[model samples]
Target: MGRLTGRQKLGWAVIAVLVFVYALFPVLSIFMTSLKSTSDIRSGTFLPPKVSWENYQQILTAEGGARDLFLPALRNSIGISLIATAIAVVLATLAAYGIARLDFRGKKLILTTALGVSIFPVISIVTPLFNLWRNIGLYDTWPGLIIPYLSLTLPISIWTLAAFFRQIPWELEQAAQVDGATPWQAFRKAIVPLAAPGVFTTALIAFFIAWNDFVYGISLTSTSAARPVPAALAFFTGASYFELPVGAISAASIIVTIPVVVLVVLFQRQIVSGLTQGAVKG
Candidate 1:
């Protein structure tokens, strides 16, 4: 490709700026809102009259009402999301390898079923799951949420990892086996290392899905025992029944958003490489 002319470069730069503003404007608005005092929120101004950390204090400090609500939910969100991501990545790696390497009956069916499950409406299944969980005594528990989360994360994990596995040359595994390594050793030592980018990318995607889930979190959990952050945000309250906890909610949102931003910033290269590797077959 030839170098761009000055005008082309300027045009591209303008478009990049526009895209950046469009993407980050909501986050910026939330940050500004988080800084506003409760009274200042009603002033209808985009920028706060005076910056206040009261909202952050309300959610983060033990003395505040929201602290109890936010802290447990934060813990649940982290623990459940990490557990679900780890399980999905491990299962997906094994399942995807089989699908990529073996010629089995119903392989297409498994792929199609996974795709279907991923797109299936969560609302449609929540009622049945709710009743079933109640009958089985799994309601309002971590396992209840984790089981449903697998349905969401597993399908896409399988698809992404399968495509990635297909791109990997099978000779590496054969070479390891020929060197006297057992099948398990060959896979663990040789194949797993090469699949790290794809696995990491899939785990991140799966965690995002589980973390952002609200429908399951709210519908299944009755208390903070298993409620994740998204669902717990709905329980935030103001000083009086007549008021809304807008600033507190905004602050909590910013806090939860920090982890996602940090993950992307730290693992951007792996994410990009994994995505492109799966897209193009060698």
Candidate 2:
């Protein structure tokens, strides 16, 4: 079509504005709420009445005692997410490459089973997982949380990486192998490097999943010391009375969200490009 008429352009602009506002409303509301006083938060205003830094201050100071307060929980969350992502990236890349490149009997069945397990709801197995952990004395432990986290991160990471691996030309690996590299070396040298963008995207996705998980931490942790920041933040208030500063909660929320945000922000281009690389071609 030729240049849109003024009215048509105006309508399009209004639609774009509407969509943007719709998408940003929750985030904008959360930021605004995070600044509210406890009273105001309970008062349930979408916007804060007065901006006070107290909530943030309390969480940072660990007013109750600094054992596993906001910062430590933040550290724990980071550690868990990063560690899980690291484990996932390594395992998934190898698994994905193997499945995508190698031919074997029931290979389709194996990949399908892996994908099927990933599709199942986490809640279904949580109870048995909890019981198993409890019996083995693994509950409320870091590994207790990490194992379930693998169930969440690994499958999708493997699937996405597998798709990426399928896109790589087989000739590249063959060329490396012909140059005296073993299959593993061929993969390490020729395959992995070129797949860096997709790998980063996979890791970023896994990191966010592990980082954002509340279910795993909530079920596994009974004490603040063992809980991740998100779960620890929950115990800040009580049914009898809201005990802590809302600013602390606000600050905690911000603290918990920041690292994941930064990780995604840094790898945003890679994630986008990798996901979109073959979209048009496909």
Which candidate tops TM-score?
A: 1
lDDT against true structure, model 2: 0.78
Q: State, as a TM-score between 0 and 1, how close model 1 is to the true structure.
A: 0.97
Listed per candidate, the RMSD to the true structure in angstroms reads 1.1, 2.9
TM-score of each: 0.97, 0.87
Q: Residue-wise lDDT of candidate 2 within 1-282, one digit each (tens)?
A: 699999999999999999999987866776776787666777767767788655665666645643246676777787887888899999998888888888989888877887898888887888898889999988887788887899889998888888888888999999998889998899888988988988988888888888888877888877654578877777665223545545556667776777767776787889897777523332
Clashes of 1: 0
Give the Cα lDDT of each candidate.
Answer: 0.95, 0.78
Cα displacement (Å) at residue 182, model 2: 2.0
Clashing pairs in 2: 55-247, 55-248, 56-247
Q: In model 2, state the lDDT of residue 151.
A: 88
